[model samples]
Target chain A: MKSWLTTTDHKRIALLYLGTMTLFFTLGGLVATVIRVELATAASDLVTADTYNRLFTLHGVIMVFFFLIPSIPTFLGNYLLPLMLGAPDLAFPRLNLASWYVFVAGGLLTLTAMVAGGLDTGWTFYTPYSTTFSDSHVILAVLGVFLAGLSSVFTGINFIVTTHRLRAPGLAWLRLPLFVWSLYATSLILVLATPVLAMTLLLVAIERGLHVGIFDPEAGGSPLLFQHFFWFYSHPAVYIMILPGMGVISELVPCFSRNRPFGYGFVAASSLAIAVFGFLVWGHHMFVAGQSYFASVVFSFLSFAVAVPSGVKVFSWLGTMHRGSIWLTTPMIYALGFIALFTIGGGTGLALAMLAVDVHLHDTYFVVAHFHTIMVGGMLMAYLGGLHFWWPKISGRLYSERWGRIAAYTLFIGFLLTFLPQFVLGTQGLPRRTASYPPEFQFLQGLSSAGATILAVGYVLPGVYLLASLVRGRPAGDNPWGATGLEWCTSSPPPPHNFVRPPVVTDDPYDYPRAPQPTITGVGDA
Target chain B: MPEAVREPFADPAHQRDAVALGMWAFLGQEVLFFGVLFVFYTSLRVRHPELFAAFAPRLDWRLATVMTVALLISSFTMALAVRFAFTRARRSLVLALSTTMILGAAFLALKGWEYAHHFEHGETPQIDLAGLGRGPGLATFFGVYFVLTGFHALHVLGGLGALGWLAVAAWRTPASDLRGSPVMAVGLYWHFVDIVWLFLFPALYLAGRLAP
Candidate 1:
């Protein structure tokens, strides 16, 4: 534990992040439970309107800032990046350690803000409400997010450098894993998107404290300008959440199918395409909010353009699964679930891309369902699958495959039951964020609440089994799945320096059939 | 596999490449950071042209213009310090870094004074935009200007502290030695801060200068 706190090792730092993020995800999940319980009835019986508002804000803030943003990149990417590149450690291990400290400090600040009369403004903190109206701890909450933004920027810098400078001698650009390529793209968005959020929030703080009136609608400030600034970062942030999930999917699908990822170049380029196109489409969020017609058209067009690359990725993943040796492992079940659910999410996103449709669905449960489908159902499944797939490597032991399979199926079923109804409710003119709704929407909300309960069980099961693995499960040898990445080419829980000597990659990742497995004896057996 | 592995590189070339690439990525982010504010200012100013222009005259243009020049001079001194370190001129590098830090400090001090003055007279655009439509539109302009420029001010202060630390480090360890390579990274950061100010100049100070 002491080593966990002060260690400069990237792998250890990754563990530290994973531990904290898991706790935070659960905390966010508890807030979600409250949200679900409130929605179970048509009236606001569970909590008052103010409590409800703060609950959703806390859930969004904790989940988005604390959980989703760092889940894949910091926890998975940080562990795998240096190894895949065959470097001893990150460009600066001390900086890597410092980033963890910054993350924790930021987390503490946020938790402190939560305990000291929680912020009522939504995660977006839309203008005058946040700047002029809110009497809660808006300044402290924004400061927490601002500090977290710095940690994100540093992580981006670390990854960009490591990917460029630390690849093994023969690990040419094309030879890199599709996962690495996707993470590289994700890091670009992180670096570009987060600083804007920092500045935007800093402005909010100034407005709230110094009476600068940047977002105060009554003070000659355009609240819409605040939205523009906030969404400019946040819209790309959605990609920041999913791109690493895409990275994980890139690894999972190919491994489970025992094939080189079909159209690797396409999948890789699509990740980059998503990052670039992400910036242009933020105005889609502002479509119903009185943006200029020109801006609206531009955003609509870019939103469609972004979907093309995403479509290419969906095609590529399916293409990889074409007539390959498909293994129905627990990880594979989650991957398949990701494909189906993410498609639903992505399709709804395209619907919202249209100006007419977006005007109708803008603040409805449809938008809520679309994001949850993509981010939670899609990205969370990918994260869980990756966690299961990499569990052997991370914990040096294998979780119960039987339990893993049940959790995956339960999560998929539970997720669909929960959010699918929200789509119907949204289209039926049900607005989101209300503590109470029309009585007609009550039944669907009840069903969604029931699903949420199942989903919570699904989420908790893995936590229990994964912990059980630590104490009783058989030791996993290096390269547990017979994978081809450099991470698999090292020990399960890799040495402090990551590499015993330096690794030199000689083949492309996922070249399963023809690729020579390194004939090391203790490769996958306990 | 572990037994087959060898030393990846002979020297620290990998480390150098990593730092260089990392620096470029950070600079790219800096562009986006300033770009968001630029876009916001451009959009709002275009929408409320007269209101944006009206508040510009009330601002202390002289103080803003002076700080811009101070920041520009600081950039030159910072570049010279980088040059001195590269040429192994230990004494000159330390001296140049100190001068650059001092210049940076002066810029922040002036900004602090300007902010205090604005706060005292209640000349803030948020409250004083009566010439605009009403309070809201005028408030938006001042809100953006204050947020954008105020955020930039924080960066300036942070840069001063970083430069001061570098200057003190050079004094302790002589910049000619191989120990001073980290200073180049610090120099890149200082220059980046100065460049942000370069953009801030036209955006904040010159918004109303082009009125017909």
Candidate 2:
């Protein structure tokens, strides 16, 4: 166990990330519960305004930075990239370990800030308020975020290098798995965008700590500049959070559908397209914040343009399931759920991209509903799906398929009930970041709070069953899903060096027809 | 003698390629890291041309020019170190790396001196300087200046540390034990740091002078 502490293996580092991220996820979820309970009524009867502010801020910071951003890339990407590529480990194994430590260090610093006083400036940390007004641990929180950004940058470097230099022979660019391509696109965004976020946060810290006027209005600096800097990194950051999840769905859809992806080139290219266009649409976030109309128009167009790639991916996944022997496995159910919910989320996003509509919806619960649908419904679903899909290979054990399917469906339903009301409430004119709302919005808020309870149950059920499986589950074979990646070619819970014999990729990925003895087993038959 | 490949790489050449590619990717990230500040600086300058004109004369351009020359020399020596490592010239490798480190240290010293001069003149980031009034423009200028140069200096310090490590390795290790890839990687980083300074010198010092 102590050796595990100092291990530089990418697998161990990935486990480290998984453990810590789970802790943060629970913490963030608990905070969300508090916010929901408070909003269960029409008034701020549960917690004080200050505490409410802190609760939501902590929830956003923890969920966005500690959990979601690193969820797929750091944990799943770290665990599977080398295995999928048929390599011993990442190119920089030591750096991989270092990134985990850095992530933990950042999480600890932010936790310390929370325990000490807690930030109330929200996760976005808009200037003037974050710089001059917020009487919270702003600098400490910014520093924490800065450290986490550093970890992200290091992980990005590792992924990009490993993908470029470590692919098995004959795994040509065209032959690579969509998941690998998505990870590569994600790495591109993480590498390019995180540094700007770091510098932006550093500027915020400097202004707050040193009384220097970088973004403070009283100091003659434009607060709008801060928004530009923040959203410039943050908009691409949305892709950083979702692209890897998209990758997981790409892998899961093919394996469960028992067919090749409909248009692999289009899907893979779209990930890169999203990454590039994700950077240009940050200004849409600033439309009502006093940005020029021309800039907003350009950004609105770009935001809609970025959604095209996402649409391509969705169509490709649907195309994959067409006329195929689809296995309704737990992972497949989650992937299917992701497609439905992500479409709603993305459709709302397109609506929000309109300069006219966004004026009314900018800070409303509509925007909140849209993002939660995409992030929680889209990203978290894919994360759970990928986790279940790879659990056999990861732990050398089989979980109860019945319980897996139950949790997936429950989560999808619970997520819808939770966020769909918020969209209605937003159209009814209830703004976000408020502890209290008009009594008319209470019914929808109640529905949202009730749905959150179900969502919590949905989230916790998997934890219980997954942990139970670790102890009493049956042993699993290497290719339990009949997956056609290099990872499946190795043993379940692969060896330290990943492969016994170095794999040479002779065929394109997801070549289901060419697989020896294609056994499309039921989810129950392990 | 052909060197044995490290774990995770199939051969020595593959390992070398991976390391070099990783460093270049990292350098690309650094470009964006510093690039944001340049954007901030440009936006602020455009917003406050008069304030920049007033404060432009306060910066010590002569000292900055000297530091730029030192960094360029350091980069030259770093390239030489990579060349020597490739040829298995251990003594020359040690010499070139040491020279790079010395020049890097000189650049830092000059930067440190410039910072001290600013502090003495009350041109610090924390307070409104003597010549600059209480408006945010001049203070913003100095703040940007400090952060830009401060981060650049940290990179130089990191480059120096990398150079020192390479120097020691070249000095103590056998030719068989020395890896040319690590040397070249460090050299790439050193040159990147130098190039960033090239941008910073003009952006911080010369941009203000051109402010109308």
In terms of TM-score, the best-performing candidate is 2
TM-score, second chain, candidate 1: 0.83
Writing each residue's lDDT as its tens digit, candidate 2 over B57-137 gives 888889889998888888888888888898888888889988888888988898888889888888877644344345665
- For candidate 2, write residues A254-370 as lDDT tens digits: 887888999999999999999999988999998899988899999999998988899999999999999877888899999999999999999999999999998888799999999
Off by over 4 Å in 2: A516-526, B1-4, B128-134, B208-212
Instruction: Return the TM-score for each candidate structure.
Output: 0.93, 0.97
Clashing pairs for model 1 are: A214-B143, A219-B139, A220-B135, A220-B136, A220-B137, A220-B139, A220-B140, A221-B136, A221-B139, A221-B140
Candidate 1 residues B118-164, lDDT tens each?
A: 76876564554344335554456666777777768877777777777
Per-prediction fnat: 0.63, 0.72
State candidate 2's DockQ.
0.58
lDDT of 1 by residue, A484-510 (tens): 788887787888777787888776678
